[model samples]
Target: MCGIVGAIAARNVVPILVDGLKRLEYRGYDSAGIAVHTGNAISRVRRVGRVAEMEAAAAAENLQGTLGIGHTRWATHGGVTEHNAHPHISFDKIAVVHNGIIENHEAQRQQLKALGYEFTSQTDTEVIAHLVHHYYQGGVSLFDAVKQATRQLSGAYAIGVIALDRPDELVCARMGCPLLVGLGEGEHFIASDVSAILSATRRVIFLEEGDIGLLTRDSVVLHDKNDQVIERAVHVSDVSLASLELGPYSHFMQKEIHEQPKALSDTIEAVLENGFAAGLFGARAAELLPQVEGVKILACGTSFYAGLTAKYWIESIAGISCDVEIASEYRYRDAFANPRHLVVTISQSGETLDTMEALKYAKELGHNMALSICNVRESAIPRASELVFYTRAGAEIGVASTKAFTTQLVGLFALAVTLGKLRGRVDAQAEHGYQEALRQLPGSVQHALNLEPQIKAWSDKFAAKQNALFLGRGLHYPIALEGALKLKEISYIHAEAYPAGELKHGPLALVDESMPVVVIAPNDALLEKVKSNMQEVRARGGELFVFADLDSHFSESDGVHVIRTPRHVGVLSAIVHTIPVQLLAYHVALARGTDVDKPRNLAKSVTVE
Candidate 1:
């Protein structure tokens, strides 16, 4: 994933571009660069590190301009270096910043080389600048040249272009990646995500696939692939600027973990008011539910775990069979679907490349009954889907997601209950009871968050371990997977999750005193079976960290530490039980001196395959 930002202003633009890049730093941080059109020429400054590095260079040189494009790269096609950084320029010095892979760059490079174009960097993005320069040399306008160049390129891309000749205008286009235009007074801005431009302007125009926009200081013009003019609608965002800050917390991850209580409460409040379900999903589900035969969920990383959890919720509550598949893998599979089948895609960033592609593929298959549960409004997932359920989690800056994941679970849970009521699977009394529990979830989640101190204390004991095992059954199995994933992602610990019953087959041999086994033992039908598996681990002298219900028979002992969670029923318990494991991973990583915000070789948004 990479972040792109551009601005045309009546005043100095370099500072604005750099500040935007700072807001977008979470999307990518490997390298940073900016290209500005000064009075006489295009000035380019780039460095192979954080945005601060490039900003230092810019300040040292006193670079000033009123039009510029900047980028923070995550290094997909080439190694992270100055040569591979963005704001890549052509021989004529025109610059471009891109946020997606150019899949057919090799062939384009070969053709350019045949035309005597010399290459300077090992990046697919460089080919775009050269291609634009190639067309510009033939007397095409900069806007037309960029449009023509895109016709020769293949694969996903969201590009912002600026040239010396067109010093007053910045051109942008998107194909299967996210790019947005921010509307302001006497100024216009473009960025890969809204967080970058929110301070300058809350009103935004989201660019669609195959759509192009030309930006000037005063106006923005939209056009389709054929260069035909199109009307653009402006959407004002409701996210407060304060939500992006970490406040008094030590880290973004810790702040986000603590924010879960409020996030969940907000989501529950939004979903459970009197007759809110009828107003929100009643008519929509009535129109779409009877036509749906099954569901296909497309997601990646933590959102994929939420999808897995939703599979249990939908099947058990609505009597609908659902399949959860990774978006990257789902795009390549020959899965069968029809107009009657619904596709549900989950993404926090909504710019996840594979998940976006999967949504595109489902649309191509004529599955119009599409629903997206996303946090960011006007994100690509919401743009590509037929219906959207926006998560109320404000802004999740931590690379290891906390509030976003829990809020997504809440959204999916609400959707499942709504669907169950619409399909007659839930009687009125049962629906009311479920709604009451849903209303109480926010307070329950706050109580769960209160258990963090206990979880942090437990994490102190296991921070030195090199490996840990997580086990659960039924709906909790996905919770186990998510817990293990969090530990591995942030703590750099080698962790694995298995169904408690599968322990004896292979995972049991790895158990010993040095190894820690974490079990999700909420009171359920499978609790006894999971308890037996815990006994097996104890027999082998394995240390245990169990998240169990207070009424359960499990108790704390010397070899075992028990974290008691409030009692919850059905799939809701899995949601409540996940908080402790998330806190454990957060605290463990904190204790181990790991970079919890930006883990090694990980990006917040996976925008490429």
Candidate 2:
């Protein structure tokens, strides 16, 4: 996924746009470009690297304009080179910045070439600027040209166009990707995400599919594909710009990992204050609890792990059968869903492509009671669901999710406890106790984060290892899997996670001194079984890094490195346990000199198949 930002200000907007692009750099970092409209022409500057390079090049020259659009590209349609960078210009110098894929661009290129249009770069976005120029040359208004060009294009796109002739206007449109309009004082802004313009304005208008936004310094206009004017309202975002900064951490990943406590606590507060549990079933949860026969949790990546944790909570606490499936696979499978079944989708970026598709498919199959636990408001996933519980984990920037995953778990736990109380499985006193435990989660997470020094001390041991294995049992199995994923994703290490009992089935051969086995050995009922598995690993000369509760009777005599965490309840332990593992991955990656923010061959958002 690419990040796009446009501004039409009364004063110079290039600097503001560059600053906004820097804030939105987490979206994409392959290349960066900017297009600003001067008095008579559109000035463009681009480079094939980080935004800092583009800024350095721009600073060497003067790029003065009051209207412009900037982009940080992830390079899906072309390679990472200067020629493949964004702000793809037409023969007449019309510039465009795009965020999504054009599926039929090859055929469009052939048709345009036949009409005597020459292409400079091998980018699908280049076709859009040429297409727009073709329509404008044939006597069409700028808005009319974009409308005509988009009608012929197939697939998803959120595009911003700036023409030489129209210096005051910026035309933008969205299909399946995200786009938002920020309302400011005598200024207007457009961005792929709200963080880009959060500093300029709090009021924003989220563009829907087929809605076109025409931005100017004074006003913004919305129109349908049919060219009919439409009225749209603005929503003021609750997130502040300060929330996006890294504060004192070395990386966004570290800051986000530490923010888990506050994130989870805020989510708990929101759920209680907004009556979200009561909102789930509409009639105080008791009337509808008996009717729910099954639950299907759909998500992708780290959110999928959250669903796995939720499955355990729902089955154990609420006495409901539950299954967690990856959204990409869930959309294609033969789903046994009915009106009595609930489909819950978890996503941090609610715009995740596969999760959105799965939510839409489930709705089409007549699952009326669908719910979303999403961090982003007004995203496609929330729009596709019948109900939503927003996770107040403010903008997560790191590619590997940290705070968002933990907050989703908190929300799911709240839902499970509410349903358990409603269905007579737990009394009010027990529900209150659980709620009180949730209230103290933020403090617990802060305490867990205080173990950073110890975690860093063990970093060299992990950095020297070639492979790692993570093992856990019961609800902690998913945490083990997620810990392994974080290590592999950022450090480029070969890591595998297994349910401790499953090690004997196949994974035992891989245990050796060259491998570090991470055991999630919280002092739960399965602690003994997990410790037995640890012994098997030790017998095979596997280096051990065990995360255990303070009072757990795990011995350190077997050359195992034990990191003790504060004793927490079974339901809230996942939140605390995730912190040390995340810190371990962060320190290990840092020790190995890896690019912790943008890992190789991976983009922040997977918008395309």
Candidate 3:
């Protein structure tokens, strides 16, 4: 993913474009560049590092303009170099910054070369600049040229363009990628995300697919695919600017890890207030929950692990057959679709491309009932689904995803209890007990947060290790997978997870003193089996790091290190266990001196396939 920003105003827009690029830096940071319309031509500055470098260069050049567009690139089509950085200009007239892949860029590049246009950069985004320049010839306006170029492109994209000829105007379009138009007095802003321009304006209009936006200093307009003027409602974004700031914290990942208690509390309180009824999902959830013959979940990355955790609860607590599929893989395969099966999609940013496509594919296969569990409001997945549940985790800035994962589990747990009650799988007393346990989770999570000191110490040992093995059973197996995922994501350590029962089959060969084995052992029915697996690792002279409960009775020894949880958190232990695991990954990354918030080659949101 790449970040894109554009601004048109009566005052100099250099600082505004730079600040917007800074806010969007989390989306991409490999390279940065900007194009500003000067008196008679476009002035450009490109750098192969963070936006700060580009800002320094722009200041040195005294780049000044009333209209501009900027970009921070993640380098999908080219290497990280000054030449590959965006704000690709054509004939020193048309400048463009773009996000998402252009599937037919090679073909377009060949045709542009035949038409006598020279290329300066090895990027698909350069094609947009050349194509726009080609169409803007023979008296075509810049806005109409951009609209015409969009019709010839394939794949997802969000492009922002500016021309020296039309210095007071900015033209942008989106197809399958996020784009927003921010409203301001005598000024307007365009960005890949609302957070990038929130300082300029709280009022925003989310541009749908195939919609083109025209922004000027005094007016904003939207045009549909057929060149018809369209009216869109302006939404007031409630996300506070303070949420994006890291106050008294060294890194965003650590801050998000510490914020888990409040995040879980916020998510769970919504369910407690609503009494865990089917209506908690939506008004039609009561009618939909009772008619479900099976449950199918589609998700990707950390969200997929959350779905794996829900599969255990849905089957054991709700007495329903559940299958969890990776969204990217699910979209390409024949699903053996059944109309009676309920399709559920999970995503932190509801705009994840693979998950959104899978939701569309499921709907195409005759599934009438669809549900979405997401954190973002009005994202594509929620709009495409029939019912929706929001995880009130606020803004998760860390690329590794700390608070969003735990909050998704909270929502899934609520869904499990609600389905259990409706299907006669859980009695009234048991349902009430589940509710009481949920209410106590906020305090219990606080107790889990207290273990960070010891986790940080354990991370010292982990920082030196090159590999790790995580072992768990039943519902906790998914948590082991999540723990392993977190460690590898930020720490860059090679890690793997296996169901404890399968240790003797194959994973045991990798166990030794050099390979640390992390175990998730809560006092559940499968605890004994997990303990035996731990013994197998110990017998093989493997170092064991166990995250257990007070009732689990696991003790520290020469080869084993035990950190007990507050207590066995019935049914919700998966959510509690995730906290310490996240802390382990965070601290280990710190000890290893790796980038915790923005891991290498990873984007916070996977908006491209």
Candidate 4:
């Protein structure tokens, strides 16, 4: 994934472009560049590093212009170098910045080469610039030139273009990747995300697929693919600038971890107002949920783990069959499909490519009832679904998700309660008890956060380990899987999670003093079985680290270490158990001197499949 920003304003836009690129640094970029139209020529500056490096280069050049487009590249098609960076100019007439793959770039380049046009850099974006320049000379204006160029290209793209012939305007188009236009008083802006232009204006217009926008200093005009002018509504963004800042924490991950309590409270308070009723999901949830024969959850990565954790609750409490599938795999496999099933999709950004594609595929197969548990309001997944539950977790800047995962759990648990009541598995008294327990979730998560100092000590021990194993049974197995994923994603540790009963089958052989085993013992029905698995590890000279409940009364032995948590909160135990594991990952990454926010080769949102 990459970041793109374009501004056509009354004042110089170099500073605005730089500020917007800095806001999108969490999306993971290796090189940064900008091209500004100086009325007669396109002045370009490119650097092969972070935005700070590009900022210095821009300052040294003293680049000043009223219209410009900037990009932070993640290096998908070419090497990470200054020569391959964006604002790929062609014929020295137009500069373009793109945020997706051009599947037919090779064919386009061959045809353009035959037309006697030369290329400068090894980027697919250069082809787009040349195509527009070619069209601009064929008795067409700049707006029609860019629109005609986009029709020939294939695959996903969110492109921003600035032509030297038209210095007062910027043109942008979107097919699959996200692109939004920010509305200002005497200025207009374009960015890959709203956070890029949030400081300038809260009002924005999210561009739909196949929609092309022409942004001038004083006006914005949108058109569909068929060249018909269309009116798009402007929505106010609720994300504040302070939410994008790191405030007092050393890293965004740490700040997000501590903000879990507030995130959980805000997400659950919406359901409590509805008294955990079926209508809480949406208007027709009560009528549709009871008619559904089964439920299918489609997600990826951290969102997938949240769905896995809910599979336990939905089947146990609601007494309904539920299946969880990876979105990328579910779209390709020929599995069971029925129109009566409720297809649920989970994503933090709500723009995940695979999850959105899977949801669309299910809908096309006649599954009309779709639900989205997501964080962002204007993202594509939420718009594609029939009903939505927004996780008010605010802006999650960290590459490895922290607060979003926990908030998704809260949303899914609320869905379970509603479904349980609809199925006659839960009565009014039982629903009230679950509701009260949910009201205490914020405080319980805060209490779990107090165990950070101790978890930091465990992190010090974990920092030296090269391999680790996480063990859990039943409902907590998915939590163990999530914990292992957190450690591997941020800390670069090789870790695996298995059901505790599988320890004797094969994994126990790898357990030694050099390997550490983290156990999730929540004082449930499987506590004794998990304890027996721990003994198998201890007997093999392997060290043990256990996060047990307070009532479990686990003691520290010669080879075993235990950190007792607060009392378990029934179905909410999985949500509470996730806190210490997240703290462990953050602290371990800190101790290892790794990039805690943007891990290597990972972007915050997977916009490309």
Best by lDDT: 4
Q: Please provide, for model 2 over 1-609, each residue's C-alpha lDDT reduced to its tens digit, 9 standing for 90 to 100.
A: 889999998888888889888988886568899989888878888998789989988888788889899999887877888888888889755789988889999999999999999988889999999999999888988888888899989988999998888878889999888888999999999998888887788899988889888888898999976668997778999887878887888888988997887788778885556542556423434455556777889999899999998889999988888888999998998877688887889988888888888888887887877778899888887777766778889988888899999989987887787667667887867877787787778887888898899999999998977799999888999999999999998988889999999988989999988889999989998888888898898899988999998789776765699988888556888878889889999999999999887787777777665
Candidate 2 residues lying further than 4 Å off, grouped into runs, are 225-227, 271-276, 280-291
For model 1, which pairs clash? none
Q: Where does candidate 4 clash, by residue pair?
A: none
Worst 10 residues of 4 by lDDT: 278-287
What shift in Å separates residue 389 of candidate 3 from its native position after superposition? 0.7
Q: How many angstroms is residue 276 displaced in model 4 relative to the true structure, after the best TM-score fit?
A: 1.5
Residue 281's lDDT within candidate 3 is 89
What is the per-residue lDDT of model 4 for residues 1-609, given as tens digits with 9 covering 90 to 100? 899999999899999999999999999989999999876789999999899999999999999999999999998888988889998998778889999888999999999999999987888888999999999989797888999999999988999998888987899999888999999999999999999998799999999889999999889999987789998889999999999999999999999999999999999887778777777677777778888777899999999999999999888888888999999999997766788888999999998889988988887777889999999997888888888888989899999998999999988998887788888889999989998988999998999999999999988899998999999999999999999999999999999999999998999989999999999999899999999999899999999999999899899988799998889878799999999989988899999999999998889988888
What TM-score goes with each of the models?
0.97, 0.96, 0.98, 0.98
Q: Report model 1's TM-score to 2 decimal places.
A: 0.97
Residue-by-residue lDDT tens digits, candidate 3, 441-467: 888888999999999899899999999
lDDT of 1 by residue, 291-361 (tens): 77777889998899999999998899988888899999988988787777779899998888888888888
Model 1 global lDDT (CA atoms, 0 to 1): 0.87
* Ten-residue region with minimum lDDT total, candidate 3: 20-29
Off by over 4 Å in 1: 274-283
Which pairs clash (backbone N, Cα, C closer than 3 Å) in model 2?
Answer: none
- Arranged by lDDT with the best first, the candidates are 4, 3, 1, 2
Question: Which candidate would rank higher by lDDT, 2 or 4?
Answer: 4
